[model samples]
Structure formats: structure tokens, C-alpha cells
Target: MDTSTGATVAHRSWRSRRLDPERSLGLRLTLTVVAAFLVLVPFTLLALLVLGAWPPLLRLDASIAGSFHGYARDHPAWVGLMTVWTHVCGPGPLRVAAVVVVVWLVRRGAPRLAVWVVVTMVAGGLLGALLKLLVGRDRPDLLDPVARAAGYSFPSGHALNATLAAGVLLLVFLPFVRYSGRARVALWTAALLVTVVTGLSRIALGVHWTSDVVGGWVLGVAVVASTSAAFTTWRSGSGRPSAHPLREGVEPELADQRPEGGRA
Candidate 1:
């Protein structure tokens, strides 16, 4: 009995070491990808800025807005959905929702995720603000069939906030969903489609230039990638056990033992 117990202990110890390998590797890969994206986005943006592409992009945005305005004029029912989306993407309620999610994460899950949530929120807002100020691009003067308040409109706040909220929420929720191999692909495809439509809505509403929407997208992606890296690294280093209870329960068995006869 004593010998068998000793063997089990040794096996478990070895398995634990083998399973983790290096906790930092996932974090490192995430950081590397984010860094590559960051380097690429700005260079592309600079080229567009230098080539004076803003005029055409703005015109495109205006045309989209005009199209939507015409549609709304023709179909009054469509106005309701647009209003709902505008409200959902607005600053006040979205910020409150972000705070609530962060608090929930800090209390129930790893605090690292919560911290990243907050950081991403702040970074998204600040980056959008700075870009808008620096770009100083004018909002569309063309009359919208549906009137909106006047503002400086490079890097649309609606697009930025919507993308930030949706992207971060997806990051937080993805780990929780139990997706089969095929389901995961479908899930990601749907998520991409929703994100694209939401961004386009801002341009369609005459609230942002096309370049503004593109910049918002770039910033949102950067924030999600970088925050995911930082959070993963922090959680791995803490060694406080997974905050995910289900994961904690299964990890020991899976990580510490191999299937007999190659059957799971």
C-alpha cells in the first residue's frame, strides 16, 4: 500500500509539471501577435493619411448615410431599430455596463480579467478622444433625414464604444461557452459579422467617416489583444488556482493522469 501511494504521488507531481509546461507561453504568443498588429496598423493608417484618402472615405460615408436616411424615410419602422442601437452604443449606458461587468469579474473570477476590462475601457475611450482631437475631421454637413447632434466626428464615438463593449464582452464570454469544434467556428463567424455591422451602422447614421470607423476598429482590436495577453500572464503567474470552478475540478484529473489503453 505504501509503495502504491508513493507511486501515485510521484506520478501526480510529474503530471502537474508536464501539463503546465510554461504558463508564460500563451501570454507571450498573445503579446507577440498584438505587437505585430500594432506595428502594422499605424503604418497603414499613416500611408492613407499621407495619400489624402480622407476626402474619398468621407464621401463614401456620406453616401452610406444618405442611403440609410432614404431607407428610413421610406420605411418608418426601421427608425426604431436604429434608435435602439444608437442608445445601446451611447456612452452613458455602455460605460455603466462596462463597470458592472468588471465588478462582477473581480468578485467571481480572477481579478486580472477585471483589471483588463477596466484598462481596455479606459484605453479605448482615451485613444478615441485623442484621435478625434488630433484628426480634427469635420462631421457631415449634409442634412440627415434623421437629425443628429453636431460634433467633431473623426473616430466615431458610437463606433468606438460599440466595438469596445462588444469586443471585450466577447473576450470575457468566449472562455465560458462550451463550444464543439464546429460550433466554435460558427460562433466566431457570427461575432465577426455582428461587429462589422455595428461599425457600419455609425457610418450609415452620418455619425462618422469611413476612416474613423476603421481607426476605431484597429484600436478596439489592439486593446482586446493586449489586455488579453496581460490578463493571461497575470493569472498564470498568480498560481491561485483557476477561478473557473469547473476548470479547477477537471484540471487535476486531466492534467495528472493519462488514459488507460489510450481510451479517455
Candidate 2:
């Protein structure tokens, strides 16, 4: 072959390999970096606002807190419900639930999936706590408060942990419902409801500002996305078939493995 033609063929082959998402670690790393940038940028901006005590955000936080506190003070029933919801979905309870899930996964012979759950939750929880300490923002101080909590509250731990739990549960169960459109929709809807309401419960109880909840939500999402991307990259490197989390769950192979109970 002519030198020019040989060069042309090599160039095309190189371009094709780079563009192949399944085999290209470079492409995956680039995507992971972009996703982290997108998630962290807003979170950092929010943290800055909190640290600076920006007047506008403070005003917004006050306005929402006042409104929610006003209603909470009047309706003893509503406050009661929120208090229950917050504790049930709080960081402590969620962490316990995650431990149970990890045990379940291990018993089912999915140790890797179990580790992912533990790592995702532990990393998110620690990051949230670290940010809270660094930000050193206080809880909403309201007269006649209906509910009380003790912590540095820039990012609500309840919100952060709940978001992590919701995301983990949805991904773990997605494979079971992958073939049923309605089941998939229900799973997503449930996750959204839990994550949203848990955060809202914190605000409604006058324990956290809206911005704190937002920061937690954003950070939680970033953790999940970052870890999921890492898991995907690992799967690709390990010769596993590429599967979308939303469509096939983080561990699609789990669907084929019966729980230990079913084996005997």
C-alpha cells in the first residue's frame, strides 16, 4: 500500500477506537470528570453562599422557614407527622437499613453490589458531615419550635442520607422491575417521593433551611453519580456488558441469582 493510504487507514481506526464508548476508558474517564464538574459546581456555589451568608439566600431561607414554622406552630397534627417522617427516614435509620441490605446482598452472593451500597452511603454521610462542620451553619432558631435537632446544619444529614438510601434502593431493585414499564415507573416515583419528602420534613420542622436541604440533595446526587460512574468503568474494564443503571440496575446479574433462601 502507498504510505498515504496506510496513514489514512490508521487514522480512521484510531478515531473509531476513541469513539467506542464500550472499550474506551479514556472516553469514560472524560465523562466521569464532566459529570463531577457539573454536580460539584452548583454544590460549591451553594456552599459559598452559605459561608458568605449571602443576604438574598438568607432572606429566602428565612421566608420559607417562617412560612413552614407558622403552619407547624398552628397544626400540632402536621408537626407530629413531620417529626415521625423525619426520624424514620433520618440518617441513623437509613444507615441501619443499608446495613440490612448489605447483609441481604452478601447472603445472595452479590458481595460487590453490597460493597457498593456500603461505600456509597459511607462516603456520602462522611462528606455531608465534613461539609456541615466546615460550613458551621446553625439550625433555624424559631420561637415555639415544634421539633428540635442538634448539629451544624448547612447540609441536612437527613436529606443527604435519605437521598443516598433512595438512590441505592432504586438501583438495587431496578433489575427486578426492568421488564415491567409500570413497575419501573413506580420504583422511580417512590424514590423521588422519599428523597423529596425527607428533605422537606427537615424544613417543615424548622430544623433546617431550604438551602441546606438543597445542598444536601445536590451533594447526595453527586456522590451517587460519581460512584455509579466508577462502577460502570469497572464493569467495562471487567468485560461485563454495558448496561444503563436506569434500565438494567447496577448489577443486572443479581436478577438471575436467587436469594440464599431460594437455593435450599
Candidate 3:
């Protein structure tokens, strides 16, 4: 949204041209479909597992957990690291981080994106909680659990919290990262790495079946995708397509057309 070069129509061309309602609607529908699939597929899988509809997937979960359990036995340092990761990626820490992120977004004048972040986190939490209650799957039973976690284990809370936070943050910041393509990709990669590591940590700890972590990922993708679509819709309507990062030297004229706080 830089405006230093006088008139700067070209600078704003990308946003203006790309914000077409038809294109936006198409993107929104695509995202919604993807989200719906992510959500429903995982829920159906959980139902099947709960009802013993597919005994093989349960055996596969056990086999994968067994592999992780075997690997963890020889890697004390890895076990320690995963334990630390579990606590750090737990719901409590993720919620605190989400609050910090939302405040940062609000301060950067992208309150709409802030709302997206909050809503995604909340949705992920609620969905994970509900799935756990409905499935009532048990945790992995190992002779020596490297780490113990309580409650139902159909969806790994650690994995869901990490995915929701990382996924939403990535989506929320993507549109504003126009200047640094490498940085954008690197950020996305880092988010993916953290999410995967968190899921793996649960398995290594012997606290969750492998399917639980997978379910967490599937459910988290749904919530994050939904939030992404909502955020883009808000950005298209609010005219602050580049409100995030706050690095654009000059704001666009459309930004002036936005509300006083740079929000919708």
C-alpha cells in the first residue's frame, strides 16, 4: 500500500484488482469446502474408530505408537525435548500466545485479522473438546510412558493447540507478506514444522494414539481454513488488505476509506 511515488495507482493495483467480489467469493467457497472436508472427514474417522467400524486403523495407530515408543526408549534427550514441547504447546500456553498475538494484531491496526485469530483458536478448542468427549478414546498404554496426559485421547489437545495457533497466524499474516516471498515461505515452513513436531511429541510421549494427533491436525485445518476465508472477506470489504506488518511506507487511499481504527 505504499504511496510515496505519487498517485501510486500501480502500487495499489494488485489489491484493487484482486479484491473483486466474484474472485473473493470463489476463494471463500473453495476455503469453506476444504474446511468442511477437513472437519467432516476427521469426525467421521473418529466415529468409525469409536464404533470399531475399522479395526485396522486402530491397529495402525497402535503400530505407529509402538514405533514411536520404541524410538523414544533409546532417545532420552528426545524424550526430554518432547516433554518440554508438550507443556509449551499445551492449551494454556497457546491461549496466552493467542492473546498476545491478537493484541499485536489489534495494535497494528488489523482488528479484523485479530478477530480471525481469536475465532480460529476458539473454534479449534471447542471442536477438539467436543470430539474428545464424543469419542472417549483411551490413551496409548505403554509399560513405561515417557510422559502422561489425562482425559479422552481421540484428539490430541497439544497438537490442536499448536496447529490452531500456528495455522491461524500463518494465514493471518500471509496477505501482508507481499514484499518478502522467501520470508513468507520460511514462516509457513516454520509453522508447519512446529505443528508436526507437536503432534510427534504426543506420540513419543506415549500419551496419545497416533490417530489422535492426526485427528487434531484434521480438525485444526478446518478451523484455520474457515478463519482464513473470513479474514479475506473482511480485508476485501474493509479496504486494508495490507494492514498487517505495518511495514508499508505509506497507506493506500482505500485504507483511508476504512474505519477510524483500520478495522471493518
What overall lDDT goes with each candidate model?
0.62, 0.90, 0.73
Question: What are the RMSDs of all candidates, in order?
Answer: 11.8, 3.0, 10.5
On TM-score, the stronger of 1 and 3 is: 3
* lDDT of residue 1 for candidate 3: 42
lDDT of 1 at 13: 69
Candidate 3, residues 55-92: lDDT per residue as tens digits?
78878888988898988999999899989988887789
Model 1 TM-score on a 0 to 1 scale: 0.68
Q: Which order, best to worst by TM-score? A: 2, 3, 1
Candidate 1 local lDDT, residue 185: 55
Give TM per candidate: 0.68, 0.92, 0.77
User: Which has the greatest lDDT?
Assistant: 2
Candidate 2, superposed: residue stretches over 4 Å from native? 1-19, 260-264
Judge candidate 2 at residue 217 and give its lDDT: 96
